[model samples]
Target: METTPCRMFPFIRSKTAQSKNTELTVNGSSSSSALYKSNFNLGTILCAAAQDSPQKTAIVYDDKIFLSYKDLDVAARKFASLLMTGNYAKGAVPCRPEDRVAILLPNIPQFCIAYYGALYAGCIVVPMNFLFTEREITGLVKDSEAKVLVALKAYGTEPTKAAKKLGIPILWADDESSCGMQALLSSANPLPALIPTSPDDTAVILYTSGTTGVPKGAMLSHMNLFLNATIVPNTIRPVEPDEETIVLAVLPLFHIFGQTCMQNTTFARMGKLVMLPRFEPGEVLRTIEKYNVSLFAGVPTMYIAMLRCPESDKYSLGSLKMAISGGAAIPVEILKEFEQRYGIAIMEGYGLSETSPTCCSNSVRQGRKPGSIGHPVWGVEMTILDEKDQPVPDGQPGEVCIRGHCVMKGYFKRPKETAEAMRNGWFHTGDVGIRDPDGSYRIVDRTKDMIIRGGLNVYPREVEEVLYMHPAVAEAAVVGIPSERLGEEIAAYICKKEGHEVSSEEITEHCKRYLAAYKYPRKIEFVKELPKGPSGKILKREIREWHKKMKSKL
Candidate 1:
């Protein structure tokens, strides 16, 4: 077989552009360790380091499934081979180049294989939340115009029903039965050629939080994701050659924050990724202790849960060096307690799915303020904008806008929405933020979520901060509930610490100490837990809905 000429990613070839201090040999390749690329596809490059140390542990799941770099490559390629060649068991799906393939699997080994394999086969990947219901799954598949569905047997008949309704084939993961990922991986067919895909091509379509309406798919290009993945590791802190960073991957892989920051970054450096299908505080602690994981990227709730875990001191988490907190603005109280408890700092950042989920981040080398999402990274530009879409002065709160290489191509098939978000060459994040004198940005609240109480605009974050100060409060969320007298009254929902019997009266009294009389939550609720999105960001919309229903009943 003759080989066609295909160049590696252009950035890697420019040796002069690379930093001499940053240059370190990796993957047994002459290329600088910072540049991880292959066939201009996100999948192929993941295995480049496997060529160097095929035996280096690539993935670990539940302390049971351990796969080396070589094993991961073989499985990823074999799955890609199955998709491209279409030679598989009866009723298996056959996908052509550029076909949109929806993946609905938990954070299992198959999820990684399918994620990279679909990209390798020149198919656009649509990673659906494994927790999505049948209807939610159908909506995403229909919206993306997916030609096939790759899911797991644990999803029951939801995928089958959705696939049949959509007139597409469904392939199951983990199972060895017909049309299963295991069965296909065991096939004797040779791995297929890595289909050519342009850098501008959309590699993945990540769905945003459907807070306003139906979730829009953010189309991220090959260069969009690849550049962000490489830029993040080096721009923050370059990992030493001998220090193979082990990342605790508890954040759902389907979410953009976890997918890019945790999963993709781990593969770029040929580091070990310890996967957990779900986040159980004790289980996560045990896994971290077992693996000696150094780096962890997680949301605020996960950190809260770990710190609040009664047996947290039992595990020796001294191996942990850094913890990244994103997805939502973490309460300053939670951030401090976590750092104090774990003896590690939490690097907070801000980004949306449309921005490939990370643009502004607290630098590892630079000093970090408790709540401020430190300055824009590398080529990314971040500015606070007024209502008129013009830049606001420093210390003035406004909409957060971002423009950079990490931004998505557009919202898939939503030209009008895309135009609305990408006006004036910047992706307007609906969240409100203010820049401090030091160039760090602090989020006030989502513009839509802000409460106007008796003509006074009260940001929920301000009230939540006071609630977090209460010693009994483990987790807290503040929202605006409709008020007959005041237009909108502040409501605070809190999950108190274990063994602490906190009351609504105590919470309301405590908030009065720090917050202004108008900003204090008059309506205090003690709940077992808050509704969270895939990345553990508390969903305020659900709280509103629940309040409305409860009031109607009363």
Candidate 2:
């Protein structure tokens, strides 16, 4: 392996380049001076760490299945050895750095093994969400043109049949259950050394849920994800060895947050991971109390369910030292109440799939303020830029722009979209927000989702927060509907608690008490469920489509 000088690494680019978009400044400081790189790959470093701490427990599931550092190393090595045999060649013809390999599996131990196995074999991993429809899964696999796929028994032959239809080979880790160490113990060629990859090398290509159009693959490199894995852990809370940091892994590993926080961070620091196949509010509570888990990461809805649990007082949740909420803006009401009830702080962070997911996070050590996503993680530079690409004044809302090591390489094979996103070296996140005098930022709304009612700009987050204060509302999502008078009027989709019902007029009346008359929801639709994306975020685009369909019928 060739070692490159840190200064010469391509990941660290020049910061003084003139911006194609106008510069954004807040309180006499310009966003143009900040720069970042996407150059560190985490999996390679973590596997090396496993060799360093061979006897330490690295993974624990169901409080029974445990794997030490040594055990993980052996499994990965043996799996990589198996992959190296038969028609496999590192950096060979037809398998260049740009080629992709699909990984279709549930959140099992083998998922980690297969993920690292592909990296060890020098192939870019395309992690598929296991719950995706057959058509969706097939579209992603075919679009990415993946050569090999690895899955487990829990995933039936459905994916296999799909792979066969595409003429791609599907290898099952089913033998893992019965074989134990046999496959690993069998002598095979030594695992190859880490491949020489630049900061620009394609690492993982994640496909976005195409609510508006065909799904596009977001390409992230080793450097992109690796930097996030290191920077996020260091920025939020320092990892302490022998601290007994048992993490409850309920978030799907396919999502970038789980991939970095639960898996990579655990390996980087040698912490124990307790895996859950699926999230059950009761099961999650039991696992935490039983394991004395220290670290918990989840979305707002998960926290709401746990706090609202009928037996909430029965569980010993005091063991949780820190929790992180992302995926969407958490209501300020929920934040205050959850902390007051649970005796633990829920730190909020901001990121997108395009940023290798983490850019800013609230600090656990620092006292948190309501409705803030804290400060930028180490090495991240955030700016609130106006439509002209100029920075907004302090406490003013604009599009949230990020420059960081956690940024993804580009949209896979889509240069035009990549160019539009990565303008002037900074990734243009479409979400709008405002930076505080203290450096924290609060998301206002999506750039396109902001409603202009009677020429009064209303952020849905503000309106949503007011709706969340209602006791009968279990889940709520706000969208804009076409209106002849206001151009776009606020329409809300709400899921009420079981045995609890509220009329649209009453809901609107409740909002009118808390919000401006123009900002209050004018139309409401009661639904059993809201549309959600692969990562558990409300799919507002779907809601908009539904609204359009319903209006067309009228």
Best candidate (score: TM-score): 1
Report how far off residue 180 is in candidate 2 (Å): 12
TM-score of each model, paired residue for residue: 0.91, 0.86
- State residue 320's C-alpha deviation in candidate 1, in Å: 1.0
Candidate 1, 1-554: lDDT as tens digits: 11111121111113322223322221233223213334478775676766787777788875555777766666666666667656544554566667888888888877887898888777899999876787898999999998777787777588878777887777777566644666556642324345677888999999988899989999999888887778876776678678877988889888888888888888888888899989889888898888899888888899898898878999878888778889888889988888788788888988888887789888777768898888888889999999999888999999999898989999999999999999999999899999998888999999999999999999999888888888999888888888778788888888888898978888878888888888998888889999988878899999999899898321
Among all windows of ten consecutive residues in candidate 1, which has the lowest summed lDDT?
A: 1-10
Q: How many clashing pairs does model 1 include?
A: 0
Please list the C-alpha lDDT of all candidates, in the order they appear.
0.80, 0.73
On lDDT, the candidate that comes out on top is: 1
TM-score of 2: 0.86
Q: Number of clashing pairs, model 2?
A: 8
